[model samples]
Target chain A: MNPRRRRGIRGNTSIVESVRLTKIYGSGDISTVALNDVSFEIQRGEFVLIVGQSGSGKSTLLHMIGLLDKPTGGRILIDGIDATFLSDSDRSEVRRHKIGFIFQAFNLLADLTVVENVMLPMMMIGNGASSAMRGEAELVLGKVGLAKQVEKQANQLSGGQMQRVAVARALVNRPALVLGDEPTGNLDSKSSQDVINLMKELNRELKQTFVIVTHAREAFGNVDRTIVLKDGKIESIE
Target chain B: MDFRLVLATKLLLKRKGNFIASVTALVIGVMVILFNSLIFNGVAEGILRDLADYQFGHVLVSKNDGNFVNEDLQLISYVQTFSYVEAAAPRLGSIAWMNSTEGASLNEVDKIVIIGVDPLRDPKASLLYSTVNEGSFVASRGQLVLGSNVASDLKATVGTRVDVKMVTASGEDAIRQFVVVGISKSPGGLAFDDSAIMTVEDIREITGRERETDQILIKLTDRSFQNELKSRLSNAYAEENLNIQTLEEAGEETLAGIRSGIAFINLVGYFGLLSASFAIVTIMMLMVSNKTKDIGIIKSLGGKSTDVLIIFILQGLIIGSIAALSGFIVGSIVGLYLQSIEFSFGPGLVLEVVYDPVFTLNSSLFSVVLGTGAAVYPALRASKLQPIDAMQHS
Candidate 1:
């Protein structure tokens, strides 16, 4: 109710709202709750981290918010719209125009070139295919310092380069929210730091919203806020 | 330029071995079908064409009485005037037992139909004139042309004297003496030039029917006009009760057999192509399974299921189309090679390989359709894959 308090949380603007979000796997006695009525808010342009042990369901939460999976109960709101129960195509539309994802494995299609990988979001969004999309891809790749290697295939890149390429792809559509599931987990320490630093720079210079899930504690020191999970429930916000 | 097609092409091209395997299976299946089409269609057409040329002459008109027919030849004259009619002729026929009076041991032939024809006009009606290998076509009342089979049985030459006789209903025998003026050799066909050819005068003199004609033959410029001509002729002879028929109508039993043969061959071809399509389906299933993570990644990037479907379908269509077109070329080559080989299929049944391979734009389009259609189930399954599940699969 107070604008002053709101200003402190997400600069008075919330871009994502999770209300009693619950995800249960299996059924009856064997059912395991991946997300147990957990609720949280992520603000516009804020860098947030979700941290927990492997079974604590941090990745499940990421998948729910990413629109890649549906929860058994509760709902998620992206940019103030109820996205939890949206139809598959509608969800795809939202995902295309509004959200970006970075996979821990750097899941770039090996058959495609780096530029093609980056061009994917724009193509999926169904704006007319043009050279400008590729030109925009070039600019994003340049931002990730992969301008010269655009022609290289996904497999030709190192772990760090592939992650950076993934980041470029994530930002290619200029999505309102970017989600990463341990984006730096597959990298060497040096490469992991390089990827983290690039994301930090992109968040600052572009004011891009980011919610990255990571077990790497080093990432906690760099983000605006941290949500820690224990037993599929939020234990603390720091 | 579509991203789905671009992705599909890249995927298949990178996995060149899989692509080639899919194409090879499809090509072999389609080639077999095409080859069967060629051989079966070629043989059927050849046999029909030979019948038309030598026996049926595109249309046949038969009378109830084999040895008797019209006195004025008015039916022949009327049909010959039609624009579609190329030629028409009446063949006077009689079943007679001919024995050689010259030999003490009779050269016997039982139940032979001696066809009497006008030497000048019969060439247009049948292939008998062309089959004559010795002597000449029937010219006068004392002359006759013996079929090669008959000549062999008679032990006679072109100049050999033969006695011909047929018993009438009155229990009296009508006997005639004639010299064989021509020996006709038969190549495998409906006519086989087996029946002896005689002058209309000899048949008339023997049968005592001045204008006895058993069958009327008509040659048409366009055989498709046969039905219309048959209708017209039937209407004109509504009271005469003459049996006027198209070649197809006359040879219904043979045509039906041929149709069944084609259907059986097509059934085999269908199974061949069906198994090939299953091979494609398996190939696509494996490809989609292997690319589960890629599908998840794509879905996360906002690629629609329809887009994924289009990718796999395009891959199948491209493979099918290329293989089918190449199959046409390969099958045709094989058909021609088969036609070139010769074999003896016993006595009068020599194997004649005709070369008319069946292919059309429809078949080519069908290949493309078949290729893509076979991929639909796999493609739909690929599209329905859960993004989260796929991403987590590996």
Candidate 2:
């Protein structure tokens, strides 16, 4: 890590870091370390791709970074705040206001329509944000090409369409970081391209940080950097 | 969480079949509990009013051997003592034969209990007087008030003179001639339907009874003190060979039998309602199981465990409230309908059922409490579910 190399990304800053993060499941002889001494820095407005095979610790790492889970050891810093020391409710606040997540399964609440799913985060803010933020939700959906399908239920949408709805929902709050885990895993190639392009567009236009975990090489087209994880360790950062 | 509430309600609506089933189970539970309360309250009121109006006048005093006071002079002395005592009267009772000439004619005569009463102190007198149609209860010399059944049986009208043959208390048979001064309709049932009423002296002379009464009817200032007064009087007049008893204690064995019978019915009714509560629990547990995945999703999306608890609790409250209100409405309607019909108990006692408003409200509240109580376990389980496991649930 040369100072000159770090200085090349001028005026841009890293909002996340995993300081010797480790996660172990089980105990005694059967202990399995899911994440071992994993460390990385993700900068603002950077569309970084994490490429890995199955069980390569990609999802677990992404989950830890997104504050959806707690690391068994080590501290995760988000925006210079020590996230591991925060309370469960405080962690939830960080997850709500600071980060957005898109899942490979397109975890849209099936009971809600596309528009309601997009308004999901706004509603979760608990201040009755629906009345005030509805227009923003509509605009985000329009950006994701889901304006026509807004009233249709999530269950009625195709795999690709559901992924797009999930994306709209993730970005509805205008979060600082968008952490997607295999977001295009279940979509067709064309839909995957559309979703990937949308993420890139959001990162470029909104100066939003993007950290995506995926195995599809085609989905990472023209990303600023790719961090390849292998056997619970970083293999390369290109 | 605002989103959790909106999402939970949507999930409930989406799973409409499960929601309907759960609500139905709760409604049935509520109905059973409410119906039992209505029946119990109705029977209590029904029996108490019937005894108070037709048989016991709040209290009764009598000789230890159950003989009526026959000396008119002694009776007046006893009657003048208590200022709080509203009415005191002596009655002589005996079994007699009644042969009905209409409605049904059997060769075997119907046995009826004859009562000797002071016409002025009898509440039944007004009702009997109104039903007379042809006679008066003036208790003139050698006159009688014959019940409708007895009058019909003997084919006797107010002016008809009939012979009443009976044995005096001395075990001697006597036949007395008397004009039917009044013909009164029977009060559906009790012991006196086919009975007749005579002056105290008439019963004593005919029965050869000497200064004895079957019972003394004592009306008190407060009906609740009937038992207390009966005990006190029994102690006060221990030497007089008189026994005082409240209507409930007087018919102790009978009332105990009635109470036990009603209690057994109520126990069975509660058992059924408890099983209905179990059904409600089952439905709620199923709801929790079905929504496990949705719960996980919401938790992951910033729902606290408390938020989950609120959603389920609100659902249970809604279900319980609706069921309680519906059960109350339906139960009252049914109870009121049953009250509209007049039923006979036994000889001079007809039961007119009255729907108790207090019981209705209490039963409604009971249903709500029971239904909500049934949901507490399931709601708690829903709240304690792990977000990770719940999310992974299919």
Candidate 3:
């Protein structure tokens, strides 16, 4: 284990758990191995990074864990509840009420205002936003240093500011887990570092669980532990 | 506003090209249907009004002979005093031969339906007197009025005398001499333009139908009273000597023909709207395709499939409402424009088209429903987009 990895036995409750997870692309002879028999558990409030080269299944693993895609075999437990058996709508409900996603390209609906973007999760939770249920999206926007930009549309912001807006949106629901798939993929070095520092700050302060998939090591150096993958298998834990 | 609608509005407002195309399709569709339906509706109303005003005269009372009035002058005169009778008049008609005194046999026309009217009450019962342009209506027994076509055929003019010959009810050949006093125009542009009019005394003298009239024409305070009058007449004159019927009965076959033509017109309108709905589906599908990534983002943000569907459907509904309202306004104006058109048909028949467009609630509702329904498939396709596929697309 890397020196920065915390030394501990995760106690009674884990926010997420994966058991013998397997994913394949096609059927029979033409099939490709994307992930193979991978298993892991995530403690609440832990900051974890899944690191690998391109096509090494880091993104695939993130997708499966986040419920963005289905696994070919194995089970995923979110907040200690088996999610593998949930209906499609139920899985969407789980994503709505429990999980938050941060995409690399900062998918902050460009047509929506920054505040409106932050309220997206809450709106979708209602399916058709109740507007009465809009909690503290503004507070989360303020926390991401976008207090003054709340009324501005998402497209009006810069790369770093857009990512911050997205971060604000992801955390507005106070979800149990936040999954980032190459969160800084489209940003400059400084913008990438700003987004990473912001995620770490929010993780520490809010004590929210995080699982990020990335190849960048410098920005994620302070994560609690990093799972290193090579050729669809975990090579080591750093 | 629900966030679904809010997002839907934002998407449409932000995408000017798609929004304009969608709205244009709907507007053009509704406009075509409205304009066509209005024009046909106006034509049907004009035809029916013409029949009611100039041909039918609300109700007609006839006898078994059909041409000569049965000797029931007392009941007709009695009906004239009733509250429902705006005007009641006796008319005598016979198939006669007429020729101008100055012209040879070439000027004679056979099978001329010559009708005699009372100069006093006929004007109130039939609006034909109002159409007399150059002469006074039949003023007395020896006077006659000629329709434009009949005047042309007989080579008769004002102050010209004509000889009318017919077989009387007694089976004897009889004749009368009539001086043409006026040339009357036919308001209806119908075959009546080929008929002649004279005093009831003139037709009676020629047909030997002493003190007998052929048909009793009645105009009522309200046309709806015809059915009640028909029943009352049947109860009073149930002997089959007198028959009461609505003027519409005379042209039921013609009206049925016109109705079929109007049905075809309505069908064409429906097809126009159908093509327009297809256009909506095509353009909306394009919009959905362009915004697939947006779909994924919404899904990732916790939006359900139903929310996405609502957004797209709401966009279409908005377009439909705006287009339908605008089309209705424009169609009303067009109906007014068409109402002003006066054109002539067949030999001196100047028709003033009375265009009264009728818009039904069901038609407007149908437009809205069709416009919104056309977008359903596109919306469903957009809603079915996988969040992962959307994210991958970008």
Candidate 3 lDDT tens digits, B224-257: 8888877788887787666677867755765788
Q: Who wins the lDDT comparison?
A: 1
How big is the RMSD of model 2?
5.9
Candidate 2, residues B258-277: lDDT per residue as tens digits? 67877887787677767767
What is the two-chain DockQ of model 2?
A: 0.38
Per-model TM values vs. the true structure? 0.86, 0.80, 0.89
List model 1 lDDT by residue over B289-342, tens digit each. Answer: 888888888888888788888988988888888877877677666767767865
| Tens digit per residue, CA lDDT, model 3, A1-238 | 0112222225566777878888999999999889998888888899999998898999999888887788899888778667776665666777888899998888877888888888777876654335443447877877888889988989999988998988888888889999998999889999998889999999999999999998797777788989988888888887
Error of 3 at B164 (Å): 4.0
| Winner by lDDT between candidate 3 and candidate 1 | 1
Please write out the lDDT profile of model 1 over residues A78-125, one tens digit for every residue: 776678768887777778888999999999999999999999888776
Give the range where candidate 3 chain A is weakest over 10 consecutive residues by summed lDDT: A1-10
In model 3, residue pairs whose N, Cα or C atoms come closer than 3 Å (at least 3 residues apart or on different chains), thus clashing, are B68-B214, B69-B213, B69-B214
Instruction: Please give the distance, in angstroms, between residue A213's alpha carbon in candidate 3 and its true position after superposition.
Output: 1.5
